[model samples]
Target: MAEKPGSQEAHLSSSDVSAGQLVQDWSVKEERRARRKIDTSVLPLLFLGLLVFQLDRMNLASALTGGFATDIQVTQDTINLGNQLMFLGIVILEIPFNMLLQKLGPRKWMSAQVFAFGLIATLQVFIRDRRGFLASRMFLGLAEAGYIPGAVYTLSTFYTRRELAKRVAILFFGMFGGNALSPILASGILKLDGERGIRGWQWLFLLEGLFTILVSITLLFLLPGSPDTPKPLLSPGLIRFSPAEQDILQKRLELEDNEKRGGAQGQPIPLKLVWKTLCHYRRWPHFVSTFAVFSTWSPLTTYTPSIIVALGFDRIAANALAAVGASVALIVVFGFAYLSDKTNRRGLSVITAHVCYLVTLIVARQVHPHVGKWSRFGLWTAVNSFAVGYHPVHNSWVQLNCRDPRERSISIAMWVMSAILGLMTGTQYFRGNDVPFYSTGLRTMIIMVSIGMVFAIIQVIVYTVHNRRVAEGKHTSSDGEEPMIYTI
Candidate 1:
């Protein structure tokens, strides 16, 4: 008593009214499961790429400890000027590179740029003059310009807001891990001195850069572009999802569709749009807050080893002490990011970290010379930890406030540009003549942190008001999405 294949009774019993509908339903379920597994598997490769990128970027500072200043015959200010130029190059190129990512995709364009930067960084071994150093750094900066923002945008595509902070922290920890290990790596490489007449620092750059180049190749093979795309690493069993899971995927797809339709209708993102969005007096506070916090932090990363040397540590000891700072930074960054995600409050996390930074700096600056060296070292560690925590919260704040994809991209670019500009200005504060215990630089950091706190408070107030307006349904936009207030 079996029914025919196309019979209504058979179709209803088996839930396959038509071949097309069955195929469509199965395809949708398969895609959802694939996305969930694909997102998880790609995280390790993402972490590795970020680790390599950060290691290559930061090892230069450690390498400098091994006769770099003597070889180049430049003062600290001049060396810092080179660093400033690198930041300037990054600012100039980031946006264009991000736009290129949109066109060429993150996997292809970002990985290629990473490999190019790695090759260029390795070429630093041949440079003997300031001009050569500057050129190499400029090339390195250009190579790195799109990497971070591209990574951030790419992660956003794969993860929801609930999952973003932890993943971002994980990748960020790789950067901090690189910073922590740089000195140890440099110490080992330093032993390879006089290999073909190359110094230890030269070897550091060459080896590290080669490592990055190799990792970039791996990243090209591993990173998935979108949820719907086939992932090479995902298993077939993981390629299905329930109805609720499909709904979550639909949100991202819909957003992308809207952006494409909007762009195709000749509605390019306008300068006026950026301005109008920023015209909200509330937005100014967050912008200023970001600038101030980063301004304080920039000097630390650029000049911490030099500062430790001034504290009477030998070159090796100075590099080791810098590693301690990196370790503290790694711990604090993850801890703060976790708390922020748990509480869903970017502003509070930022304020707490900055306040800790201000206290650490003040104590470090005024500590008695008679104090034990270990005590001073502990204070320095605390300062670095607090400073490192500042950036993640600030970035989260920006991401929260800039809910629109185009605006978020532009905002991140602007924020990075501002931070780089601040670094450029702060670098001059640490002159060669002020080598040990740069009093001027310390004072400027204190002032900047205080100012940053004020702005952070302002952001909290503005965010609250904006949320209140949205709840009242008084701030609807043309697209009817609550005017896209920055909410973490």
Candidate 2:
């Protein structure tokens, strides 16, 4: 008989072994090596791709503070309308885009979307009226709709559940990083007010959009295809894992499938599956929690620069101040993500972040009328950090529990849709009439975040109850053993 795999004999030198032996004998050392290779090969591209995605989308926030509204002949209300239209496009197109992603493959489909949006963003430099602004924003939204959830699904394919949270955080850290960089970049670019007969805001759009196009072009070559299809369009061996590494990854995926759905793999996501996932008792709370959390956060993100300007800072100073919130978010997101992954308590981390956010909201509410300018600034900075920081844990919770890739895709889409809805509603709170104090908006955020905490608690209870039922044999698993417990 051949020596047992991963046994003493498995340590034989690679030169002495066949490919079959290599696959059968993948050891922990090799597993670590393969994981590191995947991380280096995959994540930086994801970070850059996501950074561009966010930069193109959120650049409008910085631009608005930099006289974009004035030059484009639009009011603050028109800018708000454009933002809503963009998000509406995203909500409408998200599901369809993800459905096509499975067929066209992530690289090809995402590359096309990125390239299209880059062109749209570049075209913003030419806008001279509300029509042009709205048209450009609407098209940009439609082009960028599914990129995020598609990227999440792609990451799911390569990483295990245990390893996913930190990776997701790292991926989304790119978004906060883009947020951190956006104002600084916009401030610098906006300095080109009349360098070539272009407005500062126009220069901001043109340069960032051009940079996006360049990255999209690079992605055609840089983004490796899926594990099943490792070749880029014209490059073979561009992202090849060793044969042993591939085998190990495939097996780990299979093991997870078996744990979740009785070894079923490649099940198509039909309408019924989607409906079931939508109604899954344990899943809905996550959506609600995320919706509420994002509702409170989105306006803060979209209008923070504007708020800083409201505090009497010059446009450049306001934009520069915006980076402080993102810097804090970057630090907090990574730290909390590491702890969530290490402890496998994704829900708890989310709850903690929410609590921190709520505290900031309360403090902001108290001080907005009574405190000095700098104190309110500090409070807003803390709110932004916690608001953005919580998202990775929320995503990880959903991803780990779904287990099925098809289900996960739909689930992520659903959550994203909810988040967009939250954003849309949140934007309504900070109307022009409420400008200086925005007391109504602050109170509403406090209420919504409080609701999010409740939803988070409900999810934890549901997961715990399900796990207990499986442990007590009140329900049966297909494998005739305890079911794989849901991630808490």
Candidate 3:
């Protein structure tokens, strides 16, 4: 086989080329494997962060029922006002905070916010009057406002539209799960009612706040900043992308561009945007529906335990009943979100949830005070389950309709603001003198729920008609590729 020198040189060159190609192939495979592994690990951490965030927010409601209000000499109106103030702060700060998050990234900003809120919450034990509690609540609200929407926006960045509903549902389930567990935690903490000169409510703040702080610190190490960011935990084998995988990533970017260009271009969301969004004929119905429904139950978080206590149940039983509401909420949220995603119909799910709420509220209103404790518990649980289930679907509807990120952020903030406004005003409806029965408040809630139902129906009609126009290619300009349709 000893040929000419030129031929031998060419043969060696071809062999070297073949070896290089094989190495490249191996590298690509390794990268793919590493990406999958990293995704698996990071997803769980994201879920954990969401869970803890929600837990911290709702724990205060349960804690307050453990005598925090009396110790601070505050009324139910004052407690709700504190919640209202917190939400007001959230309304004021959400956009700026979200923008800061976009600049600083979630890993730094979200963790810092969580840590700050925990510190403030822990310090709340020293609050001696309405003003101090109010100040603390406002700070807490400001710190926490960006967490939920930021998480939602972050999730959207990772998952496709098709995969988002389930992921969002899972994240929210963690939140409700925390809400469910808080009462149980409160039950145990209440046992230390007067231990170490610290009140039960103080222990509630201290323990939960400490736990949150610890979780935030852990997250600083565990969380992945974004999809493109690399971590040391990922194996080298998975770091490289195959030709096909690279193509897929490129296509996704192209699609994102198309979407951004097609949507209704508005000025960067400002206070005026809120008014403009409100005035959009297509959007008002959904906004009103959401306002009515959320407003009706806004007091439930702060007042449910108190309501249960007034029903002649002990503090522990009241807390337990609140847990039942959380459990029921979990079931409804999962069920409704699944169906909504499967059907690709956010409006129907919201409407169905609202109808269920209406029925439950009516039933709750009619239930006899002379009825068995079990019956009363069942009634309240049924109402709460419907209410909780309705929340996610409502939010999903809003998110789905919002094509512009800036507009979406503003819309969510406004929705939350409206809800808080209702809570602030609604608290006065449930005076302490109306305890045990709360006839006026219950009746008002029933009317509000009914009004919500009407608005939900109207939104469904509007969304359906607009979607039909989109399908027919008759309404493509205003709503991007589709007509702007809003659903509650």
What TM-score does each of the candidates earn?
0.83, 0.91, 0.81
Query: Pairs clashing in candidate 3?
Result: 30-237, 30-238, 31-237, 31-238, 31-239, 31-240, 34-238
Model 1 vs. true fold: TM: 0.83
List where candidate 1 sits over 4 angstroms from the true fold.
Answer: 1-40, 230-282, 472-481, 485-488
Each model's C-alpha lDDT? 0.69, 0.79, 0.67
lDDT for predicted candidate 1 compared with the true structure? 0.69
Instruction: For residues 1-488, write the lDDT of model 3, one tens digit per residue.
Output: 22232231322221232322311222334334544643564445556666776666667777777778888898777877787787777767766776566666667776787788788878888989999989998888877776766666655555445556766777777677877788888888877889999998888888888888987776576655544432312233223444444433323323443343211112245656656655557766666776777776666666677777867788887888788887878888889889888888787887788888888888888874668777877777777677767666666677667766556656665555565555555656666777766777778888887887798788778778887877787876644454554432
lDDT (Cα, tens digit) per residue for candidate 1, span 1-488: 32332333311232333432221222334434645664565566667777877777777777667888788776676677787788778888977776677666666776788788789878888888888988887777788886676676666666656567777777677767777788767767877878888898899889999998998777666665544443332232223434444433544343333331111011234667656555646667777877776776666666677667767787677877888888888888888888888998888988888888888888878883557767767777777777768676677677656655666566666666666666666667666666566667777888988998998888888878877788888777765554655563
Summarize candidate 2's per-residue lDDT along 2-68 as a digit string, tens digits. 2344554454433344543322345666767777766886677778888987888889888887777
After TM-score superposition, the amount by which residue 135's alpha carbon in candidate 1 deviates from its true location, in angstroms, is 1.6
Error of 1 at 193 (Å): 1.8
Worst 10 residues of 1 by lDDT: 258-267
Query: Which scores greater on lDDT, model 1 or model 2?
Result: 2
Model 3 lDDT vs. the true structure?
0.67
